[model samples]
Target: MITLDSASNNNTAMEELEELFIEELMDLLNGIPELTVIFSADESAAELKEYAEALQSDPVGKSRQIVAACRASGQRRADVKQIIVDGNRKFLWQPGGTLRVVQLLRDCETRWSSTYLMSDRLLELYPAVQCFLNHPQQTQIAHLLFTTPQYQLLHDIQTILAVPHAAQELLSAEKTPTLSAALPAFEILLESWIDLQTKLPMLSHYIGVGIVKIQEYAAKGRKTRAYALAMSIVILCGVTFIS
Candidate 1:
């Protein structure tokens, strides 16, 4: 027989949900398992080190400045909006149309994938963006043009982040993921990240820092696995003694 429990950490809403609904199901079944598989790292803390939030800070801030400049004028904003729309239309109708043009995606604090998608889309729209900013009508927003360093930063951020984004996609499948999958996936992810540093010399610093963070999390995972194994052995010994 398998027992499943829906317990939560200290979040107030989750606590309330667990008390109200999850507890009812737990009572109906029996109780939760002593050890539950924890998938994924604590994102709130781990994200700062693993992802491009740090790398993209300047670019995102610069992008926001562009938004602010465009919003300052109705005509400027309209022109910018029209440019994006035209790009989308061109994307669909152009003879050698690559793919559908994705809109400017906002990065969410909670979702790392949003950062990747946002950077990717921004890179795709770079040429159109350059034209719009350089246009005489867009003189006010000219100062907001993305710089060489900023473009390079976004490119590096997207490449390094793609690995974790892919891993997250694999782990978050609708089907139940096994605990064994985490370690191997992480190992491969770690190696890929390390290899990226060598390939992109400019990105070496961020990738190096990220590798250290991943190692820390991997160490914690190993300890948690060892502790669980020890406890399981102890429980088995107790069961044999009782028998």
Candidate 2:
């Protein structure tokens, strides 16, 4: 019924109003301390305030609330529209399309968490270990040695500690007895891993934490490859540092 793309006189006017409303909603959504402004064809201040407050409790809850309220308030379907995003919720909507009704919501802001990021980063470092260790002479592993300044020392410590855990993983996976990570013979040079850890803020603390985590996770999973991989990284780091 509502065609914003129409070339007709009345249709053009309605389309302009809809465009204005949509732009306003986008502005309110993007603003810091996020603003919730509701618009309606009737231009009822009380209704707008009520809708705003309802959204504040659960921004996307407007689906059920707005639909039910509109019915009671004698508001038509075309009278209202809202664009609600949970901080980072992504979607694309166009004017005069199917009604977007919110059923449930969660504030989708990604927490800048040190622990989660550190763990994820360590996992990312896993694949490179084998490459560096296998061909220490040919590979350039200096970049892989240190953590960025963004991390705490705890992250670094975890990285250093991950080697032993990775080693343990291999030992557990092997149908036959395998090498131990802590054994003096097996403790390959960890210069690169140490270098990476030192780049982080709280180097010593994060390294301590990382070591403990590697110990924990390495206990269950296949670790032979993990051990060999870790050993390779340690050795490569050491070799790269020497040169």
Q: What overall lDDT goes with each candidate model?
A: 0.54, 0.34
Q: Which stretches of model 2 miss by more than 4 angstroms?
A: 1-161, 179-186, 189-193, 205-243
Cα lDDT tens digits for candidate 1, 29-128: 2343321123135453233222333343456556545545555666755665677677667674334443343445554555535545655766676666
Error of 1 at 29 (Å): 62
Residue 78 accuracy (lDDT) in model 2: 24
The Cα error of candidate 2 at residue 101, in Å, is: 27
lDDT of 2 by residue, 1-243 (tens): 111111333322222322333344344444532233333334454343433333233312222232233233223222222222211134332232232342222111232122223344333332232222234452333233322221222233345434544443444454432432333312332343445556642233434343444445444323457666666776765632232
- lDDT for residue 207 in candidate 1, whole number 0-100: 64
> Which pairs clash in the backbone of model 1?
none
The model with the greatest TM-score is 1
lDDT of the structure predicted as candidate 1 = 0.54
